[model samples]
Target: MRPMPRPAEYGQWDELPDVPEVPTSRMGDLAVLDVRERLIRLIDRRRSEDARIAELEQQWRERGGVGESPYEVSRQWVRRQTTEGALMLAGILDRLLRS
Candidate 1:
């Protein structure tokens, strides 16, 4: 394999490093904690949604939700759930960032 070029070789370095500093306020700390809690809640919500999705999928299959293939049905269910999860996460992130 060919060797990759270094970032500096492309003149990418600038005057300042692109690191973000931690906020030094009580609200900043509370915001961090809120984000953590929201993240945990998001995880739990995903798990529950996944389980419900699986149960519904099994029911659908049993009720003759057949299509071209079982994979097609499973993919549709996964896609729906993923879209919902993405939207939910985007909203949460927006709120957290604004705070």
Candidate 2:
């Protein structure tokens, strides 16, 4: 096996030491707490909405809503709901950042 060459042999004597990378936090303490609260509230609201939707569905099924949907949900309704949900989340983040 050949011997390894020294770093000084290549005219390199002053090599800088390795530096540790500092992790960056996106949100400060206040903002982080606010975000956590908002997220918890959103989660609670979603849970309530889920329960209400389940109850309504059970009632609908009990009423013999079979074969086809009478008042079928439209694409616009779905899009609106999706957009509202996304916007609500975005609004929360925006508020958190603004504060």
Candidate 3:
């Protein structure tokens, strides 16, 4: 049998690179409005990333990829959980900003 494919090769979720920190000088200078605007933009960008990942997974499935394997199932579950957690955090931040 062929060796099992690596997660990256199969388009499985991989750890995203860390977002660069806001420079200390910039952070101190940002107004509350500026911070809120940046948060909104980040949330929007994250939604786009989630959509693109989902689309790629759908395409892989359409191609008859092995999605039913236990490993794959767990990987998908983890990805879903991570996405949900990020969304929850975004909602909290949005509410805080609105208050």
Candidate 4:
């Protein structure tokens, strides 16, 4: 079987522009630090959300076999995780943009 082409190999990679270095000015330094900190927090929150979702899925799977039931516990778990993650992302974006 032929290997599928990755999106990056197909010229689909979108790189973010690099942040310019701030001079020794106090205010500029503070602003740069704040932006860097906010970016770190945003990444950490996203990682936390991903980990929580993964844990929930693992727990759901370990619950037992999915028999002939109509309602799926894993599906419900995923729905809740997605909603919560979206809410968290909104808060993160608000903080990042407001700063």
lDDT of 3 at 83: 47
The RMSD (Cα, Å) of candidate 4 is 11.7
Scored by TM-score, the top model is: 2
lDDT of 1: 0.49
Worst 10 residues of 4 by lDDT: 10-19
lDDT of 4 at 62: 75
lDDT for every model? Answer: 0.49, 0.45, 0.51, 0.46
Candidate 2's displacement at residue 44, Å, is 1.7
User: Candidate 4 at 27: error in angstroms?
Assistant: 9.8
Off by over 4 Å in 1: 1-28, 68-99
Work out candidate 2's RMSD over C-alphas. 24.0
Q: After superposition, how far is residue 95 of candidate 4 from its true place, in Å?
A: 18
Mark the 10 consecutive residues where model 2 has the least summed lDDT: 13-22
6-94, model 1: which lDDT tens digit per residue? 33343221111211233455345766556545545655654576577677778878888876434434434444444445455556555
**Per-residue C-alpha lDDT of model 3 across residues 1-99, encoded as one tens digit per residue:** 434455555444344323333444455543534544554555456556667666777777777877453345444444544544545555554444444
Q: List the residue pairs that clash in candidate 2.
A: none
lDDT of 2 by residue, 1-99 (tens): 423333334322112122122224643556545555555564555455546655766677789887643322322233334344545655666555555
Ten residues in sequence with the least summed lDDT for candidate 1: 11-20
